[model samples]
Target chain A: MGWFKRIKDGIQTTTKDKKETPEGLWHKCPTCKQMLTTEEHAENLWVCDKCEKHHRIGSVEYFHILFDNGRFKELETSLKSGDPLKFKDTKTYVVRLKQAKDKSKLTDAIRVGHGKMNDQDIIICCMDFNFIGGSMGSVVGEKISRAIDASLKKKIPLMIISKSGGARMMEAAFSLMQMAKTSAKLSLLAKAKIPYISLLTDPTTGGVTASFAMLGDVNLAEPGALIGFAGPRIVKETIGVDLPEGFQTSEFVLEHGFLDKIVKRKDLKNTISNLIKLFAN
Target chain B: MATLIEIEKPLQKLLDQLDKAEHIQNESDVDVSKTIKDLKKKLREKRKEIFENLTAWERVMVSRHPDRPYTLAYINAITGGDFIELHGDRTVKDDKAMVGGLGSIDGQSVMFIGQQKGINTKMRQYRNFGMANPEGYRKALRLMKLAEKFNIPVISLIDTPGAFPGVEAEERGQGEAIARNLMEMAQLSVPIICIIIGEGASGGALGIGIGDKVLMLENSWYSVISPENCSAILWRTWEYKEQAAESLKLTGEDMLKNKLIDGIIKEPIGGAHNDPEETFRTVKEEILKQLKKLKAIEPDKLIEKRIKKFCAMGVTK
Candidate 1:
């Protein structure tokens, strides 16, 4: 309810009645409830405008936000999931899966489509956390794997926007196995000689951290994403100790030699396109 | 009273055994060599225990044993036909640590990419003790590309002590190379089966560890970081490696329990190298079985399933 309230508040505060500007003039932090100025938000990568909290952007939205208008063509979009295990937890797993499917409004947690960030052909897989907490389930895994295959086939670079709460729990062992499955797939992508860039958003944890999210060609994180495997609560519980200030956040990860760079959301497209152009195939 | 007696049956048996162990019998004053022999027999019986009973440090040792068999050894054992070793990344010199070649596994055309460690000093230097440099990872990437082009199922054997940490490796970009492998491997349309024959240590093992079916030798281990490294971090001393190992959960048993690996491949008694032929046969059978299962899935489903598998790792209770 609080999250929905925040979204509603953001929608209510926006004064543009004619049309939403391309890439917009100003925005609010997706996490903390704060108003942001256009210039300040631009400087911070359209992040929070005030609180510097990173927000989820869809593959198409990411393309638009990063590149010029209507530049991306979706690739490997048809991969879907049929319940393999017939798994059940709490209620029938399939029932919950359907609910997540309806709520997320996406076939899977990830969307893999190719587009130009800046006149450069790059395959993008954007993990939407709003979709079942952006858990990597079978369909999400397959889509990402297919995206990599497409990138290799086309001989282009890949840019993944990661915002996950790790692997999907309802899927049981079937879900946990994705860590190895995706990692293996990524290994093949490497063999094909393609560069994979990871753009870590908020709360990339669990199996996602164990596999591809951590294994980026150029590991970049948003300003405030928590990028560790064991969340702060779990880690504190496990070790019987309090975490340092900002333990799993992107800034902490960057400081600990885990991340490559911390790119503001505004500069994401320019930075990625420049990198792609620089490493032109 | 009868119910109480029935409940105490198991406890009485345990108490009797403990009493026998604690008490001095008439044989205690007998021949010293005989006494020594009895104690040795007891110790031998203790060593025979498996899986759950093992201490964390013992698991680490088991994971790192030279005679535990490695990726190269398994590949050699599994492939009955002729093999041709591939070399070079085309962008750099060949890395001996990682061996990839054209091979046939039970008549199925395949590309083999695996980390090879050494049992001795000369071999360790030659194989970098299974610690791959950037070039090693590069070679793997090249091989995978070739395999994808040919639509060959890539059989990757993972056994490494993490990526090479030398200055030269860093200069060439060790992290970047590992990351590159992770990125590229995800997109490969062709099937991959990664088997951890020995130590699956961190990023080094992960460079070639993505797979449709990821299997581990029963005694092998997989983790994000080694016990020593974890110990250095948590306790500030390598001596706390045992403690670190327990905390890190790096054992094959733990991995299988945690669902980090698909299943465990049974090994020969006294480890793989003790009975290399038997170890080879078991590995081959298991691999072939897994390959057959994976081959049935459609390419789209395969990729999707693989992605889901990764996405869902460590998400369970």
Candidate 2:
């Protein structure tokens, strides 16, 4: 059987059984409601071919897409969150961290890797939203700050893919401190004139929007990314007003000159490499 | 927001008695003028006492008082009506929430940038309640850069609960805008001073907050997070915002103790709202004094020392 047909059959069987199987062989696009075979979905770089909707992706997929031949040395970004507050609302923070680690197979939301893109050395940190909404805590902060150091030491270009809800509520003030700490570290890269490209993805909000994610030398975003300091619901509650159509979408921000460009998933690598070459002098 | 002259529950009964006594005096048939004079004196003294002993949460409420003087009031006072309001981010339309301009203080040209909370409901709507969009930060940065080009000091008056958390603000890169300001302000050749005139909550305040010396009003609160929001995450109810306020150590005294701010500016006995003119004069004098010391240093040393100063923050004293 062809890979597409086989995967589609697996999805059909899972639905027929209705047992909630671990294997998800076919997926539906949230935008256009188009069912796509999982094989075709991965091959399309996780974007919906029918609707061209950029699907939310994790750091690992991004590494494959951006790194030349999907090859790179992943940075050791495993810093403990330290559960500074011993905070618990519904569940203990440590328990939540363990659950997140189990589900995402990531030590934390961010993954840093040093690799070649179009024969140019670069450091890239991608944030994964699947891990507790990619809420930045001490681990996320320290890892990304170290990534900045890595770029400065190696004298390579840097890129950060942002996907977060905001500061991790569990971490409280510790998470908020990251805003200042990360911004302070980014200035070292700025003083060195090292090029840093910021690529924002779905649901970038809160403290992340106010820090290193926004400090890129060249700021870029994936098409239709929800990038803002506050989400729409919280804003409506705070301001008691309905937002204009397309208020915080990539196109909306680009029109207002907040971003340099909105690059397609397919074009992200080439676009970044071209910019890197421009700054190669 | 405040309902002008609205007192907290603790002082509400006293104010009500004062009001009744005044009304009796105004009724010519009553002839209670002596009682009215005593009530007025009691009200004044009571206001001073209550303000002096306010809880941190009450202070938070006062900081956002609708009738309180905002950044524009202080800037206009300092400039002595010579404030020429500038506009636009060049790339985006001007943000009404963050206002900046070329203004003169005692004949010395300086760039004054600040968050503006409008006075009335209509004006508040127009200013987005002093919460800035990303464009606002960019506008502030553009004006500061202009000031830098002309060799002028930059002063930022911070008074935002936080940056606008609207989806549009995030979409437009609010974090990037604020982060850029922090980085650029550190390297700015000209002296920079920041005054937290009201609420200095989280990254919103920090967006334009980096400076050689950071100051706060006696009642102003500066924290990593706002009390209500902190309460929501911690205790699951904003009812605990008072507790959160106390725990966060956000008052002016906490800021001074933590070394987060250079000093605290004294407000009127009943807060800036009771006497804005006196508050403005004091702020103006404080600015002029800080400017005198700041201007004496060379540009490079000013930048270097400014960076070092921020780097030393958060150290345990």
Candidate 3:
């Protein structure tokens, strides 16, 4: 059978077998059309085993994968966003926010909390790129600020894994204010003698990369992640020049020494745990 | 595609010879110190005649010189011995742009925090051009609180156009970080000394700018917002940044005159990049002098001083 047909058959079979509905599935090996099941794909962290092409995972799944036995206490989740500008640049700000909330099933773009990676207590704040491209708004700012506060209170360190598009335009000036707000929180952490490390994942860009994502005590990156303030395309357009090949990807960034380490997804848990243990002493 | 190639034998031979000429060019053709001294003499003569009416753009360029002494350089220059870096906000990732650690300056144990700008392309990317995010500021706060715990003095190096304004930064709470730092820093008991080493733009710089004694390097610039952003807002033209710079009064001289900075550390002729050693020595002396003055002040007085200093910023006539 042709590879495409086989993949189609696999998806059809999975859909037919599962009585419960799947949120949404877009699984395909670009190079080789191999039928892959979500169950089979889940094990590889959404990388196609046949072609090795990676897929984006939601923040909830990401936390589950990184933590031991899905053990994590979500902190500062109750914080809601305020419309600081009563902003009106595009469609109504409230409407866009409500849409983003519904689409991502999240109150804000990031999830911040404390969790154990191999039983090592650490703070984990993951940006949900799926949420309005993970544009940071007031709630995200408040949550991050609180996360740092929690870390300081607990005297533990933080690990932030970021995958984002940049600042949320709907929030306008209030969104811009977050840069200072977050930096101030970090200053407090510095004062408190706590450690905060950043894990730059795929497509970390804009205001996010400009701020906390780039401000890691020991910055790490996933293989092939894109890390920069502007996307290569946008920068090229703005600068009126072609970007060098492999300009902003994690490997290129690592080569340029933007990342302290280029860690593989499979090994990320162990690596972070080891670092946490080293610091704990 | 392969058939059109032609080899330039003569050119290839010359290129090969040129490649072997120098790997590491260490020896100077002229005596560097002597040449610098002569240059300084010329600068001094020129300064007396006419301190050239500097354009706002020139100040901006001066603020961004690659060779400018950054926070890390100052820390290394002022503090002797091995330094240990502390990490993590205990809730998120460690921030590289804002580096804080336990170290000794002139044999006295202290906690240090600085916004570090990397020298080369690699380091700049690593340090994010000293533009910290929420986490970097949080890390600085962590260090400050730690200093209070240990009763050690705190020194912060301020540089950066502003905090990172990216989606992730906002998502993670950039504004809250800066606000909390401003609020909490005012109450911290440790004697804090802040030195504006380079660009000190906007809230990113201010996040760690709350200090008992705030100093500015002669060539450094600090402002509420960067000239470029201001221009974009005021003129709807980023290119008009030069005009915005002039209006902002961002230079150390301007800031000192306005009482934004407590004092200015003299830089060598031209700029710090022109003579790093001289710049280093002068900064060291000034910082030591300031620290000594501050060491005598009680903790309550120190906090009060910091509060008063910030409250008084941008109070225009």
Q: TM-score (0 to 1) of chain B, per candidate?
A: 0.82, 0.91, 0.83
Poorest lDDT segment (10 consecutive residues) of candidate 1 chain B: B1-10
Put down candidate 3 lDDT per residue, A1-281, tens digits, no spaces: 66554433335556558787465454566547766776778888776787655566767877988889878889876776666435343255677778888988897788986788897788889988888888776677667777887888989888888888766654543454465456556766766778888898888876666567767777898777777754555456544766667767777666655578987777888888898787667
Candidate 1 — which residues are off by over 4 angstroms? A1-281, B1-52
* Better by TM-score, candidate 2 or 1: 2
lDDT value, candidate 3, whole model: 0.71
Enumerate residue pairs that collide in model 2: A206-A229, A209-B175, A210-B175, A214-B176, A227-B170, A227-B171, A228-B170, A228-B171, A229-B170, A230-B165
On a 0 to 100 scale, what is the lDDT of residue A167 in model 3? 62
What lDDT does model 1 reach? Answer: 0.70
RMSD (CA, Å), candidate 1 to true, equals: 12.9
- Candidate 2 reaches a DockQ of 0.25
TM-score of each: 0.54, 0.79, 0.50
Q: Which 10 consecutive residues of model 2 chain B have the lowest summed lDDT?
A: B308-317
The CAPRI-style docking tier of model 2 reads acceptable
lDDT of every model, 2 decimals = 0.70, 0.83, 0.71
For candidate 3, write residues B156-240 as lDDT tens digits.
8887877775545544656447655766777788888888878877657767877787788877777756777656644667887
Error of 2 at B19 (Å): 7.2
The root-mean-square deviation over C-alpha atoms between each candidate and the true structure, in angstroms, is: 12.9, 6.1, 15.2
Alpha-carbon lDDT of model 2: 0.83
